[model samples]
Target: MSPLSPVLDGPLQRSWPWLLAGALIYLSFGFTEMMGSDLWWHIAAGREVIQQGSPWLVDDWSFTEQGSAWHNHEWLADLLFYGWVRVFGVASLVIWKWSLIIATFCLFQQLLTRISGNALAALLACTAAVAIAAPFLDMRPQLYSLLGLAVLLELTLFRSPRLKALLPLFLVWVNLHGGFVFGLMVLAIVLFPWRECSLAALRRAAFTWSACALICLVNPDGLRIFCLPLVYALNADSPYRSLGEWRSPFEAGGITSAWYAYSLVIGAALSLTWLLPAVRRRVRFSPELVAIAVLSAAMSATSRRFIILWAMAFALLLAPFAGALLRQKLVQPLMLPALLALTIWGGLRVAPYSLSSGIAFHYLTAEYVFPHGLADFVEANDLQGKTFAFYNWGGYLHWRSDGALKVFIDGRANTLFDDATYLDYVTVLGARPGWIETVEDSGAELFMWPRGRNGVRLTRGLLQTGRWRLLYEDVRGVLLAREGFALPVTLRLPDDSVDTQLTAAYLASKKGDTVATLAAASRAHEQRPWGRATCTWLRRSLQANGQLREAESVMEACRAYFPSKYLR
Candidate 1:
């Protein structure tokens, strides 16, 4: 019952490996990418809540979605993350992210070690879990779900089978993310025996599950926020199907750790089930293990994201069976020579693990840096006005800019912007025909793009137009603006030209004409698929169209023909 008892009462030998595993797990998160996309949108949403001093009732932040339903479901995480940024700046965000990751993995590792004495097996499970979770790793509310699941799992399996501890975890998990429902579902799986569990334990788990469901009432939005998890799937025919992470499993790689490890595990257990068919069988197939095995099997054929869920489950299930196999003298230790070869290979040949140079994933490299340079430029010139922005840059810009420039857009996404506002901006960014005109019309006095991109090929061309001028440039980025310190004619873009086509397609996709946009972009690609700007815009157009598959198709074509021109 005591928190310290797990550490203090245990001898140093057992706890040290678990603690070392914890340290290594947290170290892994250092390389995980920052949450830049929807993660930022959450921060922006939280800021509005902070300013308004009220939870979102009807949406009111953007000029676009003046009145619409906005689910600030992650209000708690948003506020906490946003507040942390305010207290310690972005460095704190990174710290918080890595800390959560380390904490989650450490807990999971502990549970796994509790079930399986093999530290190496536990390490493999966590490492494989990290690989599948790469896509979604970052500082997010959902991490709370992952961490809570570990706690929930421990209580579900290792406790007195009384199911008394489930309520408090369930209550906290509800505020963290809708992933708590997953914990309840996991509980149901662990308690699969409708007939086997004592009536008291069944009643307790049911009451705990109900209590957690009811605890959603304590959130900022009251009982309404509970609808968010369900409502998120309305437009999604199968939200899980559309989203790789939510899919049942095996969708990622059927042969992932589950099949390889789980089958090896449960198969051994099943083998023993008949081999020793005695009441005193050293290995017992608890319903929990069977249920976990079923989930693992399903997820193995689903998406890579669910690999973590089953990896931990199967690892635990395998421990007892491994011992059972050891009893029959079936388990074999590595040969001395082979063991040395593996150790040497692991150290010299394997370059993946880095205790020295921290390897960064693409998100960290692609994420927006604080625009200290641009902010300085505006402060020096004192010529600030509304500016256009990319989705990626919009969030950090909003955080650091101090309201000097009203961003043409920020990370609020389409839901916050409604159809027309989102598409209109999408149109302008694509340099669609009359995009310059659209900027002028919006009174966008300045332009800013991610540094090193050279996105606007016309940046140098604008030098002669006298309608717009290059204001500033830095190693990090650049800035441009219209003449008369006001919006005016800039370089004229061609009608139905590549830029125009890109702009139109981009906007149309935002307007929900995703298919037409994808086809148009595909047609454009047919002419010059490898063109730098064309390929660049083509990728966005594909993503906008929700044609990730087609996007990959174009990218493959571009990379095949022009290796150097890959859109990255």
Candidate 2:
């Protein structure tokens, strides 16, 4: 089959609404200008590979695990994404990201249409699948996985069963992402005899499955690449426990999109099995769908990161049964069109004010920009000694420091850093016991805390010690150096509405400047009433100003809202 074979060659009358809905869903996600936390390191590694003419074989980004053996499994993917950034810039990559996503959903919708023979069924299924997978969509290696899965499913379900087309698919997939193993697993499941399949069909599937597995070794790392999955599995017990993506979907309390998708998929399965047995009988449950569904469900339950993979399988497996059920139960003419319009409108409302804003060369934002500034200060001051860094900012720091500076940890999680390092990070950031000892033992010369998350606790703890000096502070981040260490520039933070006021409150109390402190703190509190840091600052200011009644009122409000021991 040609490259465009998966795209439907049919008329637009029935397909356009479903396609439009899918496009809207994907665009909503793609419009966000922020890249994934991992994108920075990937691009950095890619740039290294391009310039140095060799792939990174050992860890160099972190201070703790520097020179340790590193697994550059997705080297090819890194090269491709970075190459795109070099050629067309980040804005073009954003467009390219959305294009790939759009193509993936188009192929998926085409596959659903083939299976259900109902446009409305395909539309609803595609919309739900996109919704479930929306959060994971970005300019990352996973985009290739999405596209690859769509093509793989189309070939397995819609096209003739042949091993020839799958060889090249696996060849490309192995280099793109480690998720290729998932595709092989799905194929293995499809090869199993759940339904009446011919001997020739079984032989072809067996050939394709084995060939794909063998082709996975075509990468630079060769056979060692097979161990990537094992590394990821072992991460379950590592620092990944604290990361949101690694958490179980059921562990979260609120109603996230994953919950909705999970409920729908599980509900559809149960309803088909028990409530609508007649529909189940009519709609043949193929071996491929059954295998994909079971495997995807188990994986999704274990890790929320795999929910998109499960969502893809869910959309495909449930479409036929859902179509049959809907056809018999309801008859409405404008329902599909209305759904398309609503999805488009929702996507529009949620899209960034400018689709291309802050999406060139780098995703510059207040959250990420502050770290870059801090890194610049660190470089200018020649403070390349041991440094404690926020976990998420490690990637950006590694990229921005031109390989001259190393971090305590990065987004690699358990893949590189040990569990102890992660525990120390959490302990220090949370102001727990052993935190000061952790910092002292590491021989760290300076610490950089992203202000939004851990800055308040860290800043307060450092102030209590009196051993560290505040060097630089901003709404995005705060930097502290060991006492007696001189900075290249004077210690003066920019006057931002948030961090400036909070910092002023802290500094004023230290200097016994009640009037200035209270004024700054009160303004910050009014600007953001919910922030614990602002509340803490305001309360401290009120107390330092000799306003015991107002300080108690602030404390009461804090207890009412946050109810944390830190406030007490």
Candidate 3:
């Protein structure tokens, strides 16, 4: 009998309700606020593409590389986002994001079910995969690459492989996102079969692989498309490598989060299946799948971006064993209930944070994560000139100002920026020696910067130079202009929001100005009496000012309002 024959007669045949429940629960995990930093520029770019006839190949959005070549790999995806927003409104992008996520996971579950013949096992594997992938599933072009991979695996790796469909898939995928490189790698791996090394099978796989690769070149980038990944990898001096997503999980610290640890465990388990002959004999995993799983795991270990791919591969490679475990005497009786309970627990944990008041998506500026307020101040004052900005806020500033305010750098990174440009940005941002000179040399009239820990040194340095005058300040960002620069009006502490007060407290604490820290923290606590972070900051500031009794009182209030563990 075929491996899938038993599925028709198994409990899965009657488990539609359970599968539906699992899918809904999985969808809940993604219902958080849309807060991707790069998303703003994407929308802006998409708008430009729709208004114009074609995507701009030159970087006109930044002052540093105004005419530099921009390898716009994700133009198609950006256009789609723009179309969705234009027709259905901005909130629709959230729905679009969740739709892609659900589709990808659905494909994963289907593939797992076909391979393992156990819907319950497939569901459990998908849940584990979701746990690892949830953090990285922001609304971006990368989502297309993820969904593409899922579809590719379903078509190529599952029973009766559809090799011909991959050509068109790659043709479209190359335009959607740069992740088509991974799909090409997977196709190449599948060219060689594990046990049966037939010449005909080899020829077929070779033709499909070559055809898909050539189809990828049909995009706007042409031959340059193939060179993009290489450029990112080979550039040793590129500051983009220092980004958190690019760093290896083993670096700085080893396997910090439970999700990373879980991925490692999955990778190790897959490796052991090949290393141990006994286990290999028991589990009839395809060698190509094993190779793909190993490659994905290694890539994920080296760079965090590949974790979702590894998670998908993990479900594919281990589903059979997961199914076998479910059938075991000890597990079979309790498996269904345990899985349901676990799903419920996960949903409950996520729902509190995921559930929002409304679905109208807005740029996330909370805690200075973005420069929404600074951008507003600049636009309101008609401030225009070369601006030095925090790197993360580059996209938002460009989008919000509609290209009136160009930035030194943005999320485009290697796509438009060279090593020297990024290095200069890094030097000035860190307030390294000669930073003031670098800023002066750039002729930047305005400085749109953060006020948090990352920007504290730079903010202090700008103040000390006595050349940059503060134009605006908020909880998240500070806007400054060169001496004698024109300004319509200056709004200092524009609102008495808790975020502004918290920024004040942090800056004061950094300078060891205990009196200012205490005053700011006290105001912040009053503004946000129930906020855990605000409470903690207030308590610490009070303790620093030698008010032990007041600090104790703040801690007591904090304890009353929040969980004891949160106080710690």
Which of the predicted structures, 1 or 2, would earn the higher TM-score when compared with the native? 2
lDDT of each: 0.55, 0.68, 0.72
Please give the ranking of all candidate structures by TM-score, highest first, separated by commas: 3, 2, 1
Q: Estimate each model's TM-score.
A: 0.62, 0.77, 0.82
lDDT of 2 by residue, 189-296 (tens): 755544557887687767767788898888877887777754544456656555676666777732245444564567356435734557446675455666677787
**Clashing residue pairs, backbone N/CA/C < 3 A, model 3:** none
Question: Model 3, poorest ten-residue lDDT window?
Answer: 357-366
lDDT of 1 by residue, 1-568 (tens): 3111122222322555545544554454445433355565566656767877866535543333435665566667777777876787654555566677777777776665555444443444555555455445556677787788878777756454443466667666776676665566677776544445687867776775666567557766677655545433333443223333445343452223324444445545653464455722555545566566566555544444445555555555555444344323233343223234433443442234323211222234234243445555565555446676554566665554444566666654432444455566666555567666666677666777754344455355445567787766542455787776743234322335444454456556657787777666666666656554456667867787577987778777765543431246
Roughly what TM-score does model 2 have, to 2 decimal places? 0.77
Top model number, lDDT: 3
Runs in model 3 with CA error above 4 Å? 1-6, 13-15, 31-35, 87-92, 230-237, 253-257, 274-281, 328-339, 357-368, 454-456, 484-568
Tens-place lDDT digits, model 3, residues 137-187:
777899898889888877766444565677779988999898899889987
TM-score of candidate 3 on Cα atoms, chains taken together: 0.82
Clashes of 3: 0
